[model samples]
Target: MQLLRSIGFFHGNILLFCVTTGAGIFVSPKGVLKYSSLNIAVSLSIWAACAVLTIISALSLAELGTTFPRSGAPYYFLKRSLGSSVAFLSLWIKFFIYPLGIATQSLIISTYIIQPFYTRCPAPELPKKCLALAILWSLGLLNTRGVLTVAWFQTISVLMKITILCFISLTGIVLLGTGKKENVAKFENSFDAELPGASQIAEALLQGLFAYSGTSILINIAGEIKNPGENIPKALITVLPMVAVVYILVNISYLAVLTPQEIISADAVAVTWMDKVRLPFIFGSIAISLFLILTPMIHSPKVEYIYGFIFIFSGLLGYRLHVHLNQRSVCFDKITCYLQLLFNVSPPEDQDEGISTGKKHLEEIFL
Candidate 1:
């Protein structure tokens, strides 16, 4: 039986937008501001550059999606275009790395969602973890219903996010117009802050790049995308720039209302912005689970080489693990699913033929 291409442009747009706009938009403005050495001009420039890269990445992924027309996102494409080893590495990352991010985002949402009750000290971990688990389980149940069900939820969520972000932006613009230009009062002196060194700039760029992190997520479900050639590009072209503009405008609003010091100090930049204006709003988030991926950049200087080595190591590690496992007849995916169950991570799904190909290469190389 074949899968239906039920995910049309509308759903695709939601997926792209919602995945790409995560807690980063709310939180990373501070990182962007901080890493850029508190320079507003440098901060905005980093954002603009990231926005352009987002477009480029989406367009490139569209070409690849249409060309491969495969499900399992990078898993299949990397196998076919590059090799099984590379694809196998992505499978490992999907299983291992993604779940950390998922948990982080969930906790962020839980924190913000429960913040109202505490209103003073931090929310206790027990309640926060319970709420996060409830949220994760609820979404897990929703996913079992099918793609469209998930898409519809994303649609509602995306609309709420856009609305709040727009509210923030418009409010900032109004403040600027009304002469409450706290950060941008003197536009001429905006660039007066000294630029940081290369390491700091690179760190700032990473912060900015991650701001557009999940745009490539559509490729994960590329096979489900209706008319991959047309709809993929259309959805990306339609949504990303709009997100980019929102990000910039929101940043401007933050600068307009809150000073750079406040931006850097706040726990959540958006939350702080809202608090400053006394805008009573707190919406549930599914995207805050995506920010944990930023940790490696902060911890390592040789990140590029580290990433390359990890992929190579994953291929070798996968091969060795598969060889030792007694279930020679079972596919690698079934084993992955078992691991998922144990970890409370993304539970395994039925995979396509491409997944088997990863292990097949190891079989050929060994036997």
Candidate 2:
């Protein structure tokens, strides 16, 4: 059965907003800071650069979604332009990655919730994992209920998260106005520090991009939107920029209140921000209520990237071999083209040469 187009531009806004502005904002500053050599100027520039990249990526995906007008997501595109085996391999890798993603998010959320309780020490792995599992089950059940239900839940949760972020941003502004200028603004010597290596710059960009990684969320569900042509681009173009702005403001707040070294040292930047602001003890309770996130499986920061790189490299190699082995048919008229391609079957009626635009199709993973 096909999905109902219950998701209008309004709901699309929520899903896209919530998907991109996830917990990576609060925790990922740590990774970005370390990689950017703890220079406030370099870090903010990286954040802005990542935001631009995300916007470009989202716009490109919007074009693809409208052109295809299908909910088949990446697999559909790959199969049509590339071939079926490549698409199958994408699905195969996702089977494992999705669960890993869920667990990672749950772990990060649980870590933030549990950290406040252990003020003197890091929370134990047992409790964090247990809480994460509970959260995982709850999310699994939530998904089973329906898309609308999840959308409503996301709407409510995202509002609270935004409120908290605004409050933090305001606090930073107040601090700046009250002569906390040193911490509030530190751009004078931003790039004067020794430059980070190429790898470090790349890693910093990766960490910053994670906060905006859900650019494809709407595209993946394009068929469920009321009018993919108008609504998809409208939502992505409008929502992602606002998310990027909020993230930059929140990071400014983070920098305003905490020293570079302190930000680097903190495990959960949001929790630390709360403590620095001297918010009531109840703030911790509230944060646990408002926040949910994902962390890497191995816990160390770099290990997660390593695992991701390995999987991505494997997938690319497999795709190359698969595409090489299964060369697409020279002609597809009166033939079922690439269900194997998507819901389309070329009928030898049009002037379009192929689903793939050229004699030699180059693989370009833009995002």
Candidate 3:
């Protein structure tokens, strides 16, 4: 398969970072409160673990992508390794997961945009569905036109969000140090050693886990990568540590600016904190909205056009690694020999004769 020579390492990694940190500014405080009851160490530990898991998963996938270099990553991996049933099931999950996640974030972004105009609009009847559909379909059209455009949009959005976060973090920390008469009790209480209840721990962990959800976007573009093995893994590794640091620092800033109870009391912490500091509620809402919707949309092409490429790449790599770790199987050798003969040769090998021919034909329809 031929990849468009548009996106390079910087563009790809920027998108990955944005996707990895998408919407966390809005949801993370509530998650942290639930788990550790304001215990900074526990909350930080949970976040660190999640970041590590994302990195490790990406590393394993890196090896797979290097060896296989196929499209439809997850789909390819499962299908080749397990069988058709598992492969299809995995693809089905991918189909639902990405679209639904995008739709849900879109609705939230629309709400933020709408809130400024219609402060009196009832929460239950925000009419965000229509707005979400518009954004979703618009982005869909953009992606269908070309993925490079999507990557550029993602990079810009990410820069915008980072600027907002840095501004908020810096101002909040400075304000706190000035001995302002704000409620600093709850944030200071995070150092207390009272353990949280089991339910609270579960809820907080779940929320933190969501922060790591989009790390797989790296896998989506595996086939198009300049060097799938090195580039993909390197991007993931770089993004994870950066995300972890940003998350921890942002939370600290929130704690410094407003008490923990204040963050938890509001429906959206980032906006509420911004509003507390005399920032316009409208501006805060808009910033938060863009962070959620814009970041995730950057990774949609993989979900839409080449859904399973990363998985396929990963699976092939896994098979190769398995052979390296253990003795090579005769079955594996025979399958590869037959696949090479049919797919790479002129008189396609029996089973390969039809499948390889069919795949080439299908590519024409999509490309």
lDDT of each: 0.79, 0.80, 0.71
Candidate ranking (lDDT, best to worst):
2, 1, 3
User: Candidate 2, after superposition: displacement of residue 21 in Å?
Assistant: 1.3
TM-scores of all candidate predictions against the true structure: 0.73, 0.74, 0.69
Looking at model 1, residue 244 earns an lDDT score of: 93
Candidate 2 accuracy as lDDT:
0.80
- Look at candidate 1 and tell me the lDDT of residue 76: 71
Q: TM-score winner among the candidates?
A: 2
- Over 4 Å off, model 1: 181-183, 186-188, 279-367
lDDT string, candidate 1, 1-367, tens digits: 7667899988899988998887678777889989998989999999998899879877887787778776775677788788999888878877987787778778878877876666556678899999999989998999999888899999999999988889999988888787744545745587787898899888987888877878877777887888888888888889999999999999998988788898898766666776777642322222333334445556665658688779999988877776766435455556655565468575226455545754564465446
Please give the clash total of every predicted structure, in order: 4, 5, 13
RMSD of each: 26.8, 28.6, 30.0
User: Residue 13 CA error for candidate 1 (Å)?
Assistant: 1.1
Model 2 lDDT per residue over 1-367, tens place: 9888788888889988887777788788988989988888888889999999999988987888898777866778899888999999989998998677667767888989999998767889999999999998898899898888889998998898888878888887777777755764564667787678899999999999977877798888877888899999999889888888888888888988888788889878888888887764477667765553223334545666777779999988866765777744444422333333466444444437553542233222111
